[model samples]
Target chain A: MQKSTQAGFWKKNQRALAPWFFMAPGIIMFLVYVIYPIFQSIGISFYEWDGLGPKTYVGLQNYRDLLDDDSFYTSLKNNVIWLVLYLLAIPAGLAVALFLNQTVAGIRLYKSLFFFPFVISQVVVGLIFTWFYAPGFGILPHVINFFTGTPTAILADDKYATYGVIAAGLWPQTAYCMILYLTGLNNISPDQVEAARMDNAKGWSMLWHIIIPQLRPATFIALVVTVIGALRSFDLISVMTVGGPFGSTRVLSYFMYEQSLSEYGTAMGYGAAIAVVLFAIMLVFISLFIVRMLSQERNA
Target chain B: MRSLKALAGLALGVSLFATAAVAGEIVLNSDQSDPAPKKAMEELIADFQKANPGITVKWNNFDHEGYKSAIRNFLTADAPDVAAWYAGNRMAPFVKAGLFEDVSDVWKDNGLDDALKSASASMTIDGKKWGVPYTYYQWGIYYNKDVYKKAGVTEPKNWAEFVANCEKFKAAGVDCLTTGDKGGWPAAGIFDYINMRTNGYEFHMDLTAGKVKWTDPKVKATFAEWAKVVPYMSANATAIDWQDAAALMAQGKAANYVMGNFAVDTFKKGGMTNDNLGFMIFPEITAGIPRAEEAPTDTFHIPSGAKNKADARKFLAFVASADAQTKMNATLGQLPVNNKATAADDPFIKTGFTELSSAYALAQFFDRDAPADMAKAGMDGFQEFITHPENIDAILERLDKVAAKVYK
Candidate 1:
């Protein structure tokens, strides 16, 4: 009788636990690579070492040093600018999605061409912009000369270097967001749209009251990606300016790399400190997102 | 089914045996990416393997930037049996941590006493030698003779002449100098030159070693003089690299480049010859100010836990040998660190060697002379001063604080 009881229990629970067993590999990988290093980096922030010899404990010293670092302030300010400007991608993406959602002839080809920038690597985007901003013979410089009678090198000037790089970054990011919105639009219910039309609602009002609510998931994903991309903007800065023109275009990620790993930089402890600070700043947004997601789950 | 199972088991057994047999190879880490260096090292390894008969050498080569981060992680874990590294304060911290093998006996046996006298000074920490000198290159002003002639100016011999030439070049509608500040170290070279020329070599060494302050009058004067020449630099220099700056000189768009001798290859690739390019030692600031030349050296080190220490030491001795240095530098276009090595057929290298030997004193370039942390602060100070020359005092003050923190 006991054996029969155990068999019945196993039969019921095995199916339920199968999904989790299948998830184990992914969960372990995520925990090992993504979750653990973050905590380790934060812990290392409170010490000083040159990646060799003994580590010295220096509580709050690195943070205190940040208070007077002009580059840090410039980076923080540029990060804020990047975050604000990056949000334009969402609305711009939605507009493009709406335009491309029709089943016209060769519409697939149009969508693919529009999505080409997103498919290309960020390194290529940086190179393209670098050529675009090249001083004497590049297209943008020639255009500027045509308009203002004086050619301007966007990357060489400190005033425009950050914004110039951000514009280049935004080109591909906007396309990605557009493709996501297009997918979301394709899944919208035709019955709901017909009912909204029957209620004399159309155009902007219909989009606001009915169709827009359904795009919440798409918007959430877009916002999350944009924020993360803005925070982790190292590659574009590295390839385009290398935190140059007097360190005017330095973001935290690039600054950390410059401090820790460059030929002239071996301050691993200070770099880790910067990384920890950036991670902490990113955590606040992540926590808010998690809380919202959890509340939505509970409501469902 | 039984036949298939037997075949699978046999294959698995063979694979496992092959893996086990191949696990004893020694890995070597290097940062050289040029095909010539890679081929040269591979040939050397093949020769070593032939000599040893029982060991294998595996090469792990990384590009310049990739190797910087890779070395840090590799040293902490399973480091390679041999690696390439920079000399000076860069190697001191590693030596202090006992991460490098003491190759004193090997140095003594190889008759490297005269071959590596300069490198020995840079490699020694607390009276222990830790590395073998490989190849080093000289850094100085590389000017386009055509541009200088067009500007009606000659290569400057002193500070006054250099400034006058800069004014002449600017007046003649040419950029007097071109350097990339993207990495911030190129500008730091100018700062090092000014400091070394303003004060003596020992004083410049003291400044980098934390024995002196950043806000010292001598340091301040270096920036002051640098401000006078800032406007004459190429307008779009910040967006370029050292290679691009060399291209400008090759194209006859820029008057001069203050860079290292490694730029010889870039110039040659750009179709510029030795006749089109001229070399000059950085001029003196005053009659008594001891001028120090910037010579960046590359060296090889054997890690402490190497499995084949004898073979690694043999490789080191071979690298420092006169024949090896001559062959390597012939292809590398770099000045051999060994004084006895004959100059190659390359005219650029021959000229560079003559100017290097004629210099009053040879100081390992600024980035190597200073600790890495201090170098960053100093370079950042240089970039700030270059961009906003009026804020020199504020920049120096900030650097002074950073120097205090790092040096302490």
Candidate 2:
């Protein structure tokens, strides 16, 4: 009777144990590299350090100082601008996906070609845009001159530098969103589409009511990625401007780097504080996303 | 339960034993981007290893931008045994924090007293030496003699003559000066020279250290004078790199490039010779203001927590020796920091050495003298003044805020 009870327990628990064994490696790596570092960085934010020697506890002073820093305000404003403008890529990508969703000869090849920019490195994209925006000899300047009889170097002009960089960032981001939507479009139910058509629910009405709801998972992922991408906009800025022309194009990431690491960046504590604030801003979005996802899961 | 506990204890003992038995390795970090300098370092490492067979040396090289960010992170964590670093106020904070090993004994043993006294002065904090000098290149005006001749101009001797030469070059359809302010410090160098010439070396040092305010009339006048020469600058100068700007002068498109002696190679690569290029000290601005020369030096420092501190000190001493400095500079086209080191065959190096020796006092490059925060503010002010030459007062005011926050 004891042997039979043991056999029954093994049969019941094997599947649960097997899944945990499969998940162990990934969970362990995530805990070590990501989760621990977040806590460690937050701990470091309260101390004044130059990345060496004893760290003095500065408490809330670093945060207080940030409030009065003009550069902080500029960076925050630019981040907001980056986020708002970066979202435009979502609808723009959807439009492109829908245009190419129909079956056509060599459509797979065409889709890949459209998706190429997202595959290249952001550093390379920055270089390409820098050349494109350079004055006199660049294609952009010539195009502007042909149309307006005057050419303005986009990057050198402080008013336009951040916008120019954002536009370059969108090139890849839009392609990424397009690929997501195309995959979503591939999985849409044709039977539902036909039934909606029979009921005279067509075009915009059908899309809004049927197509978009079905693509909700893909849309959610696209928004999440776009938001994160906009917030972490550092590579392109570093390559194109290095936060120059009077730091007009400075973002929070570059500003943090400037404070922590650059030739003049010795305030490791101040840099950590800035990073904490950035992380806090990101946390708000993450929490909202988690709540929304949980509700959706519950409803489903 | 007894078997499980025994197994866990065994595993813990093995891990602790492994940690204790970890072997030591010497790691040297450097930020020199040029292939030649890296190659020279590799050769030096091979030689050092041969001399000490039991010791192992590992070289880690980083590109310019990557190095700037990574060094700080590395220093905070497991820093390398030895690393190349900038001097001046750039190293002052690090020295003050005691992140670097005090190498005063090594300095004395190597007898680098007179040769490196100036550089040592920059590296020292509270009378403790932190690093050994490696290579320091002089900053001056590198003009294309062909461009000057084409424009019917001669190299300037003083402030008035420099302005006259600029007028002539502009009239001849040549841009009088070309610079890349993409990083912003190149323009700051010009600002430093102007301040040094106008107010003298002591005042310039005082202003950068925040002992004086940015809105001082002398500082204001320096900006005013710099603005007067803006029209003679190359169009689209802000977008170019220093190398590309040198290329412009090499091609006779621009009349002058105010840069370091390291630019000699860039010109040679462009097929320009010593005859085509000429070097001069920054044109004097006033009759009696003792000229403050801008000389950026590169040195090596041993981290306080380095595992191979003795090896690092040995390497530093070797690099500072006249023989090593001569060989490295001759190959890399940089001026040796050791004054006693034999001069190279290169004309640019010889001229730079002569100019440095004759200067009343040498100031480390402006950005290096000022704290990082202040340097950023000062560079931004210079960029703003360059773009809107009319808003001098506003620029100074913004810089004053930056100075106040940083200096206090």
Candidate 3:
């Protein structure tokens, strides 16, 4: 009788339980890795802890310390610079995609060639740029020396180091955006473009009024990736300047790693505070992106 | 059906066997990923197993940089029976946290007190030894004879002559001092030598220990002396690695590099022969000060939570022996901390051994001596001072601010 009743319950709920059973792995992962850590990080930000030792609750001390910290302010400023400069990838990617849109003899080869930087790793790009700007021996410095008679090591100078790292980041980031735009370009309707051309719309007007609207989804994804990329600008800085020329090139993400996980860094609580601030900044743009994505989904 | 039952039986047997732990095995974690150090470790383990046949060692070797952070994690989680670390303030965090076992008994029983006396001060905190120091290497001014000849200057005997030679090197369009602070420890070596020369080792220790203010007049005096040499340092040094700076000296583009004995490898790899590569003690600044040299030590410790403390202590004692140290240092190309142990026959190691032994006192290098946070801030200040010597007051003030918080 109990087995028959249990079987009846299973038969009744099978349809409702099936979707949840399928989603259990993803739901468990999200809770464990993403949701729990965010709260744990926030909890840790109130304490003073070295990773090896006992943690002491200091009650907002880490954030209070950040207010007076020049390095903190420097990182915040550099992150702003990264966010602003990194967006240039979108327009630059659009330009490259527009140029590559034509049917040429060996167009597939040219498309893959343009996509080369994206296929390679960010570390390789950083290393290539490091060699290019290396003073006394690097090719770029040699060329600059030929023109100006004074060789400048851009990564060595605090004033220009962030921009130099940003330039390296932009190389691969632009290539990625170009690939997205090229795919979006492929799905553009020939009939609409033909109609726009018939209406005397060409070049800039054609792009502004007709073609760009078709590429909206690609532009949205590019913006999302670029914004997140700017927020998490760590690897290039780590490989290139290491947040140096005395910490001038530091952005928030690199600053957090330097404070917590680096060889000399043991201020775990302070690092968490930096992480919270970065998360808060990211939340603003993330919410905006989400709202746009949701509204677009509804519209579609 | 019969085949399926056999497969299930096999899987269960494999699982049961895999779950069983070895009875007399001890695990050791160390960062000796380089060829020489890894081979030395392997030899040490083989020799140890041959001597003590009842026990076995399971070693986990990590890359150098990764091990620094990994130690903190593994010490808290699955503690190793033995761990490789550094002496001095580098080990202080583990010691204070009670993660490291008090191996003072091992030291006493093994007579490491008199044998490893050169490193005993660095190994001790709260009047108890936390680990056994196996090896150390000295730091000093390494220069290029070719560059010196080109600049028309001989090796300086004292601070005045060193400063005067900087002028000549400047006139000859060569950097008198080449150091890369990208890793942020090389510049600290320069600061250590200058501070030890200017105010003495005691004052420098007090300063790093946070008893003295960074803006103290004595500290300012150290900076004043540093300011005299800053103009002759390599341009854009912050962008370069220590290896790059060694390349500068090897290429004869720079005259003097304040570095550790280990950098001799990089210099040799850069096509510099021992004939043209010279090692000298940093010149005397305050003439009456007793010479103090930097010789950072490598150590091994048993963790407090280690399951096999008996075998770990035995391993520590074995590592402390003169024979073991001699063999290990021969492979490492470094000076063994055990007084009776012989260093490698390499010229750089010989000079390091002589200098370390003869000094009035030995210090761990600045980064190892100072607390990590302070070491980083101090190195950054020194690097900035190298570039903008005029910003001395501001840099010192910033260091004082950090010291105020860190020591508190």
Which candidate number would show the highest DockQ if scored against the true structure? 3
Pitting candidate 1 against candidate 3, the one with the higher DockQ is 3
Between prediction 1 and prediction 3, which has the larger lDDT? 3
Q: B1-408, model 3: which lDDT tens digit per residue?
A: 699779987875675466333667788999999898999999999999988898899999999999999999888766789999999899999999999999999999989999999999999999999999888889999999998999889989999999999999989888899987787788888889999999999998999889999999999999899888888889889999889989988988899999888888899999998999999999999999999999889999998978789889999999999999999999888999899888888888888888988899988888888898888778878777877788889988999988988899
Chain B of candidate 3 achieves a TM-score of 0.94
TM-scores, all models, native as reference? 0.91, 0.89, 0.96
Checking candidate 2 for backbone clashes, the offending pairs are A264-B372
DockQ for model 2 equals 0.52
Candidate 1: interface RMSD equals 2.2
For residues A19-119, what per-residue lDDT tens digits would candidate 1 score against the true structure? 99999999999999989888778777788877777888998787888877887898888888888888888898888988999999999999999899989
Give the worst 10-residue stretch by lDDT in candidate 3 chain A: A136-145
Write down the lDDT that model 3 would get: 0.91
Of candidate 1 chain B, the 10-residue stretch with the lowest lDDT total is B15-24
C-alpha lDDT score of every prediction, in listed order:
0.81, 0.84, 0.91
Docking model 2 quality class: medium
Q: How far does residue B133 in candidate 1 sit from its true spot (Å)?
A: 0.5
Model 1 chain A, poorest ten-residue lDDT window?
Answer: A260-269
Every model: Cα RMSD to truth: 5.8, 4.6, 5.0
Candidate 1 lands at a TM-score of: 0.91
lDDT, model 2, position B68:
68
Q: Individual DockQ of the candidates?
A: 0.55, 0.52, 0.72
Ten contiguous residues with the weakest lDDT in model 2 chain B:
B15-24
A1-300 in candidate 3: lDDT tens per residue?
A: 999999999999999999999999999999999999999999999999988777999999999999988889999999999999999999999999999999999999999998999889888999999989998778887888789988888988888889999999999999999999999999999999999999999989999999999999999999999999999989999999888888889899988998888987899999999999999999999999989888988998
